[model samples]
Target: MSDTPIEFKDFIRIIGRGQRAGRTLTMLEAEQAMSMIINGQATAEQKGAFLMLLRVREETPEELTGFSQAFRAHTPTSITELSVDLDMGCYAGKRRHLPWFLLAVMLLAKNGKRVFLHGTHEPDSKRLYLKEVLPQIGFEVAQTPDQAKVALDTLGFAYMDLKHINPQLDGIIQLREQFGLRSCANTLARMLNPSNAAHSLQGIFHRKIDVKHRETAALLNDANVLCFRGEGGEVEFNPLRDVTLHLSRSAQQSSEEVKATCETFITKPQELDAKQLISIWNGELDDTYANYGVVGTLSLMLVLVDKLDWNVAYQQAQQMWQGRDKTWPVALPKYNLAAETFDTTGKHYAH
Candidate 1:
């Protein structure tokens, strides 16, 4: 190797050159660039410019793939002891509605599905984020990967903030407050899949992000991924609107538009409370919107886990919700096959 060194300015120059001269970074270059940033080799101004320049245009799959590779290389923690079924990314907090998706995840966990979720702590944002919402229920936010593993072992679910997962990246993600626009940090965070789970569920708000995420997942060789335009960019399906679900399985991409099954949409509650999630799950609170949102989102997740058709999955989701163990985390039980499995289909998930 030559006794020469490269600087972060070179990366910024490649992307931030005048419109005609600028071009995207190659996969290798993207990886190196992100590695520098992650290692604190890049200046604050250089990092901001690089991110915003790429954000000005659409982020290419190669860039996302390389960024994700660099991120995973630095993140060595993994729940090797547990087989994680789903990796849920929750960077975009919900604004229009309560996070019904949390209930769906809780129901699946209660019925014995191991899920690992990572999200950002957007302190300045007006929306409600998972970091604050999770504790209101019975769940506690994991401060480290070991804590996350422990949660998965007992609760069948766990959530860690991006700050704990990678404080450097979280610091860059927080730049959104100053930039007034989201950077690629959000996208890179979504693709981490730190536990290397079998399936990944992602939600996006913009028009073509689902496609972008699918392509990036294929580049990363993720086994299965479900990307969709979700409610306020959380992985909760809007039951009142027809939604198109983008899918990537074994690097083959496809999409299907599912019709809206629920006819009514509820206005945002005056006060968003986590106790309501428990109430809805326990049948104490009869919320039409919450019911459809939970069941619909659960049906989508089931499609990822069981590979069932949407209709069949929706039906199964309803059944799962009805038979849920009302008391969870307090008297958590071992995986019960009879309770978790459906009698109609002989397909038993022995996991």
Candidate 2:
């Protein structure tokens, strides 16, 4: 590695010239550039240019792999024989809706699966974060790596804030609101699995990025990677319809070959909008809604991680939801969407 500090001008020169040359940054170069950018070593102009160029060109899987490696190197890691380690990275939420991921984590954790969710609550027009949501649900959000491991050992789930876990990457999130677009760092952040779990379920809004993620995960030789499009650009779990689920295994299968084995679920959007959908997350819905799309998604995760049969996974999730309280067993207060006021930038404020 070069010992010289990457100056702002040099950073701009490389990316600017690379753009003109129709060249992309190599993983090494991308790592160095991102490190400099995140560390506040780059000037405003350099940061703006780097983000804009990357957004327009998008990131190659190789660059993304390098970016993920760089991110993980700085992020805190925990070692545990967790049966199921899930990375739920959907930070942006529906403008006026609540997130179902939090509820899903609780239900899954209740059943003795170890789940870890990583995210930063800094999205534009930020909604509620796992930092706030987890504590309300009786899980303590850890402030350090050791604290995170301790929490996970005691509780089935733990929330690791990006800022505390990895401040450099957290700084990248701060740039998003100013840049008005997501850079490669945002995409790579989703792939940063500190627990080093072999199974991962990730959701992205842009369908095209799935290919990039697939290629990146393939390059890293990921064990099992499932990328999909979420409901309404939010990473919420929508039961009414089957979201696009892409499965990648570390077998001798090509990307296309692996995708062919995937089964699609298609449902009516209206079905998802029905009160039954809300009840599922709130724990008020019945088993009919269970074993449906959301449950099926959970089942797919189980198959990927523990090699549990699909039917078995489906039944387990359904039975757990059935036996739980109608409302989420946790004491977190319901998010009153109608009553909460948010600024244009997405910060929630009590009116």
Candidate 3:
């Protein structure tokens, strides 16, 4: 076998240069790089250089596939027979307020679907993150691959940490601070699908990046991929506008075939105040935001699994949100000020 350590150094050398000299890494090469990243073979300087080079030039579909392959090889996969393996990793890291993915996951999971939410707590701009909000919402954050699997089977919502899933890649979290801007790995990290899910719902920030995300999804052999630029890159529901969705299916299937098999909907943002939004998130509002796009996304999953009609899928989502006010428990655990006080920078929290 090729010496693993030397292989990583060579991989770094290829990516460290500003120019792309060697051939685009094959799936195995990509996997090896990911192994190095997760295993911590690449030094901080090497990591920064590699990420900057890739970000400036962007990665080809093959390179993205390789990176993804490496990511999955190192990270543990949480398997569940649920029809859709939804990954909500929108880039607007943590914002100034509560996380929308937390609410969306709760709503989706309450309806008998399996959801995989993976992210890190590296705070930039603000400290709000799913890691903090999920536990408050009664979902346990898994600290290990085995724990993540058990959580997926039992709770239907599994929050996988990058540090836990892929430690080498996780090591780069602090490096971004030194560079003062995000690198290619930030985007690639979001695209990592360890579950090897056939279907995915990924939120991208920039329209240009969305294009790359779609292309990469195709390269990864995803059966169905929904890529969109959400408000502030927070995959949170915006009831006012239809969260734009770009649908892509594998090359093996015609676009017409996939389009014919899918369902689509348009929704307006439900009027809600900050407190009302939080309440709605906590399943407290009688009719906060219908969260139309989220519903539509789930409906699409239903169509994939059962071949359900669009109307049926829509109704299924409608029914879930209809009486949500009454079904959700009114008494939820209060947010601990002590916990929320810690900022993402590891500094004192201020709100």
lDDT of 1: 0.80
- Ranking 1 against 2 by lDDT, winner: 1
Show where candidate 2 strays beyond 4 Å.
1-11, 18-20, 38-41, 77-84, 136-138, 232-236, 251-294, 308-316, 324-351
Candidate 1, poorest ten consecutive residues by summed lDDT? 342-351
Looking at candidate 2, the ten consecutive residues that score lowest on lDDT are 252-261
- As a whole number from 0 to 100, the lDDT of residue 82 in candidate 3 is 28
> Which candidate's lDDT is highest?
1
Q: What's the lDDT for all of these models?
A: 0.80, 0.60, 0.57
Model 3: ten consecutive residues of lowest lDDT? 253-262
lDDT of 3: 0.57
Error of 1 at 351 (Å): 35
TM-score of each: 0.89, 0.74, 0.72
User: If ranked by lDDT, best first, what sequence of candidates would result?
Assistant: 1, 2, 3
